[model samples]
Target: MGRILDQPYDVNLQVTAVLSKLSLLPHPHLHEYLLDPYISLAPGCRSLFSVIVRVVGDLMLRIHRIPEFTPKLLLVRKRLLGLEPEGINIDHVTLLEGVIVLEEFCKELAAIAFVKYHAAASSSP
Candidate 1:
């Protein structure tokens, strides 16, 4: 997820937007550290901490109401849990772009999270 922001302009607008929103952490330094790979952090505890903080911050931001998804998600939830059991049917054709963007976003986040673990494990021995 962090790397997506550094990609060229040809990247998908929805993916960029999602990444932007996700990386909007409360502290400027922390947010900048995550988005900017050039910023140097010491290689042991601080480096690991920064990665953990960024991933956690991104996850926290994702739980809030995103304008593009909140209404639709609420409707879907209502339909599933409320009176309209049949309304769980979604129009995938219309939602294809959103679905793809979300898929990419999830994959990116997973990659970012796992990379830290992998790097740490590889360095240990």
Candidate 2:
């Protein structure tokens, strides 16, 4: 999301590109937007629901490299995988929660990354 690269934080094209890909995918599952973008919109069509959860889970695990980000990321991945507090009984509702977690992490990471970027820039020149 743009949150990761916005002001106060140095914009990293590579990071922004990754987050952008993630932002588009979670919308429909999270809401019934004007464009009607729900990935799991097809009722009883479990496949769409499955795919979104898997992809979002995978992306979250892969993108977070910072040491501070690891703990929460792992917990989210576990929940996505249905490893803790229960198993993966993913439905539209659960997927919504998952995306919310992902979005929250994105915001958190953006803030941390931005602060580091600002610090680095200030020292650069």
Candidate 3:
């Protein structure tokens, strides 16, 4: 999963991702990471989270990000409701929260991987 982000994109990785659902840590892992504890998490958020995470990570560094997904999602909702982009107002703080979620996710995942690597290395002598 970490490798997917670090490496350049490829179809092979895409296929493998679909086939394995990223091996337990599927796309919903990121969604759940982004959402509040009141929200539900599942493996069904691949497409949305893929774009959201990319956009959030691309726009800001992890340390200073706010990962609120609602406002961005509201844009899509507006279009679906046959409304123009500017027809609706956005919650700036909520939007920032969504971006922050993505940044926190990267930090948390990296820390977990770092600890895992160390545990394995230490056990190996």
Q: What is the C-alpha lDDT of each candidate?
A: 0.48, 0.44, 0.45
Error of 1 at 54 (Å): 19
TM-score of each: 0.29, 0.29, 0.32
lDDT digits (tens) for residues 46-78 of candidate 2: 432354455666656644533444454455557
lDDT of 3 at 103: 47
Candidate 1 lDDT at 39 equals 66
What is candidate 3's lDDT per residue for 1-125, written digit by digit as tens? Answer: 32232333243235334533332343554435432234444566444345545665655553244344545555644553468555555544333433334444555545554654576579995
Question: Per-residue lDDT for 17-120 in model 1, tens only?
Answer: 65546554445565545454456766553442354456556545653534546555556545534645653545332233333444455566556546655765
Off by over 4 Å in 3: 1-53, 57-90
Top TM-score prediction, candidate number: 3
